[model samples]
Target: MTNRPRIALVTGATQGLGLALVEGLASRLSPADTVYLTGRDAGRVARAVAGLPATSAQVRGELLDVADPDAATRLARLVEERHGGVDIVFGNAVMRIGPDDDPRALMDAYTQVNNFGTTRLMRAFTPLLRDGGRFLVVASSLGTLSHLAPVLHDRFDGLSSLDEVDKQVAAWRDAVLDGSAAASAWPGFINIPSKIAQVAAVRALASQRRDDDLRRGILLAAVCPGMINTPTSALWWDVSTAASPAEAAVPLLDLALDPVDPGHYGQLVRFGRALPWKP
Candidate 1:
């Protein structure tokens, strides 16, 4: 192992799974590593950082709103300046803007935060991510092909590169603009489509980066934490079946620190199990 310090950055870490992920990562940090916990709210970020267990790895709070493209750019620059590069990146920030009544409006809002924002972050940080590093996107099972219309599902399954993923997302946006999305069999839940975009992005990135990842020992994948008892999920889930944020974070933390077979790359992991994307 290199003697250089390990750096980790987690977005939307003020509460819920993000916060739990921060804590879990901090608990395992060596003295040479640092975990940066970020959120839009400065006070909330401070509080979350303060609550972390005392550990050898330093925990710092960063103010960031992933929805702003410039913010992602700045954060990536800041990490590069301070640590030279990052070892881990968790794209966990997401927004469930509203119900599906206005499909266009809901689509726009979710697309801005979950899809566009996440894409911006990955673009900004991928350069800063070190070889052999891990990049985990907090995706959801709702993003699976089962929830998509047959045409859209086939398109996503056939994605061969990141550019194609962008094209597919653009096509969906056009469909939404023309009122075709609502008429189609695509699920009405805005979160599902947003997550579908996120997972597709991860898959595309994994494919595009395959050569580098294999040569450098990097791991990239999307993970579903299940229905967690967070403010976001409280909207629909029954309290009894919902898992605590800490409980849901278990798989994420595992993937972050463990050394896995190269086969794990590009797969969608749910509850610690890697599910095949293709039949």
Candidate 2:
């Protein structure tokens, strides 16, 4: 919102929603702004940066593997040194690799990068974010509660606690190992939305702890781009039936650029609509 032009750091920016977000922000910049596109792959990050046009003198690439604590530390230090401060931080990396068909393995990688990686990044980068800026956590709607679940199920469970949800995940693993899709449903902890919300909570809290005045100025929220047809969907939200990356990027951009918050920080939003993201 400042005329000085904002500087943003977007993770997982090499493709899909992350890729589209950088493009959207780049197009909106007035030459005074800048964006740092980061990904685990050096070549991909470079290619993504090079493909953008009219980007502020600021759009560039940095290699960051969120799953690795050391890499995250390096990127955080580098950004703080280079930019002095970061105006926006977009958490959008997700792990979707699966084959040779190991269900537990797939879930392990997914949880590691999408959940733990985001948490680790928040811990390291919160200091770099200027007070009253933005931190958008990108995730999905699956984090909601389930009707069949108990009263405590999550937004994904329709009702549940983290413990119960974790148990459900273990159950699913058992079923998979036994070649039975008939296993009881997974506890909602494995739900993507809940995990994303958990990570974004840290961002919001970290910002608040840094500056008491940040209550109304900073916007830290979990945003679900909503079934974007990216290859990472594992064919669940098929590319054909969902919004394109560009289309899904719009709401997140709104949350990022909105200078004033109508609500408090740590709100989880989706598709321009604000919904409760099970805390």
Candidate 3:
């Protein structure tokens, strides 16, 4: 049997879903596979590395603030230099701009960090990702089905298409560019505020990468880890009793590394179920 484990890179690895991903991979991956846990805080990174059990799997801690323009390239280089090529990239980094924060500045930062971060990392290390390598993008249900609830049934179907979604995205992007931060739409585009920006980022990435074939996204997905009772979901999903973040990560792993799944490039899924997203 092959002893090599699948090498992976996970952003925001200091805690939450990222941390869970590392733990899960560490437990299951082959002896030779590596998992690089990246975080903005050097201390947190070190702590996380030290905390994990030392076993056959290789674990490396690195300083990576995905919001930092340079961090994207830096991480890619580190992965390439050390692991040769990362087989799976779990993009688990994202943020919510605060209410007191200046909307314009924060919105720009969101765009630059989330959208641009994904673009830069995926582009810089195209060679590092193999043709069948998986690209798991952690997104929200609000961004996928909620955005398309007005028109589609299977939100997963539209992720691979843009004709319908382009109009909505273009309108919103234009509104933002025009400084009309208040622009509105039926699905309440800006009404929900920063959340919309994250969805836009996912769309922009899918559109841009669909053509070059630079890397076979295989399963470029935006997933809603579900109403896990995490600090972030404490406000909205309280009634549901958020499942352990570690437990929520299982679906993501199922969609990403499932041996039976052919692939789900440019697809949207939540709780292991695919949905429509284009419109």
Taken over the whole model, the C-alpha lDDT of each candidate is: 0.81, 0.66, 0.62
Model 2 lDDT per residue over 102-141, tens place = 5544665655577667767766776676756777777665
State candidate 3's TM-score.
0.76
Candidate 2 wrong stretches, greater than 4 Å: 97-100, 146-148, 151-213
RMSD of 1: 2.1
Top candidate by lDDT: 1
Better of 1 and 3 by TM-score: 1
Error of 3 at 235 (Å): 2.8
- Winner of 1 and 2 under TM-score: 1
In model 1, the runs with Cα more than 4 Å from the true position are: 98-103
Task: Give, for candidate 2, the lowest lDDT window spanning 10 residues.
Answer: 155-164
What does candidate 1's lDDT look like per residue over 1-279, in tens digits?
A: 255888999998988889888888888878778999999889999888887778778888999898786999999999999988999889998876544357676666656678877888888898887877888999988777777767667767757666677677777877887889788866667677667778888888887888888678788888998888766566666666788999998888888888855777887888778776643
Model 3 residue-pair collision total = 9
The candidate, 2 or 3, that scores higher on TM-score is 2
For model 1, the local distance difference test gives 0.81
